[model samples]
Target: WLLFLGITLFQIPRIASQFKEENWHRISETIPVSEGTMLLTLDTQAEDPDFNEVSLKIEGTADSLVTLEKEFFSRGKTKAESLENAKVLGYQVSVLDSLVSFPPGFDYSAMDVFRDQKVNLILKVPYEKPFLMDRSLLDILRNTIYRNGYKSRDVREKNIWAFNEAGLVCLTCGSTTDETENQDPNEDQTEEEQINREKLDSLSRAKFRQRLDSIE
Candidate 1:
């Protein structure tokens, strides 16, 4: 009996180290607006390489101008202890007239255990009102936009949009009209373009040489 007890005690810490718990954290806010469009921006940044995923869902609702729901999952040694630790990492939502912003809630860089975490944001806005989104969020939802026969070069710095019965669309292209107008749609390359390309290549080589020199 004494030998068995000693073995069990030795295994207790090993078993406990593998224990994991998932915690859910959420925030909801309502913005008041009578008429006009609202702009929603999502700012997400994670320093930890283990930070796995961040998912966002935006839908239209007649009930509110802006509503945000965030879920956080945290894993640790015990369920109760994990949840208590997660509560320390809080987020904030801000509203200013017709604009709503969401910034990274917790300072994960300051804490070590908070490295393994995932955040999901769900935003609901008025259906009829027009809104603009930041490029960061748009990049995450790019799969939802249709891309058939569209080359990466064609849309690299251009605005992307979708049109259908639902009338969902991307607001504007990244490039300005003057920039687009200056380019020739013809297949033949211009002399000025050739010169500019060569200059860029030379600059790139110089930068590469500097990096290698620094390493040596």
Candidate 2:
């Protein structure tokens, strides 16, 4: 009985840690920054039902190299299977040259099953380096407020932003003194807002198609 109690106590910490890790799968990757402006976009990817929910946060890091942080929750019948789910999700983020593009959601076909799959992306920019988020991304950049004391939806997308000694700052916001911490990623979204964003995306797609047809 004594040995059993000792063993159980020893295993408790490991069990707790495993439980925590299982709930939150984290992935970090280093993106090579180009000499000038870097562009971020996910708008080009067509939205699919399998992977429809995604949230992204833009942050600044002093690390020099551009860092992309990803977190998600996935489940399976066993720990090994769950890890495999995470591995499949990790493969979906593709960075090409100065343009870093990630899907609004992951591809479910590769994931095997959907276990409350949610992907949250954080794009970390280097200090004083310029970056722009494609206007189409206004929907996915959720629960995040900008450094100029504004939220993603409120800021004008055409201008550039960058990280500096004070954290994230707008290169063209005109006023540089405003700085605040980013909001929590867990904020809830309203059903009305979701519907509106879907409409906007559909309209953007239509406009893009029209432009292509006119060119041809």
Alpha-carbon RMSD, each predicted model? 16.0, 13.9
| Clash totals for all candidate models | 1, 0
Q: Quick one: best TM-score, which candidate?
A: 2
Q: State TM-scores per candidate.
A: 0.50, 0.60
lDDT of 1: 0.50
lDDT of 1 by residue, 124-205 (tens): 6654344555555453343232322122233333343322223233333323343432222223446775555445434433
Candidate 1: where is the Cα deviation over 4 Å?
1-19, 32-34, 42-54, 109-112, 139-216
Global local distance difference test of model 2:
0.61
Worst 10 residues of 1 by lDDT: 143-152
Mark the regions of model 2 whose C-alpha exceeds 4 Å error after superposition.
1-22, 49-51, 77-81, 90-96, 146-148, 175-216
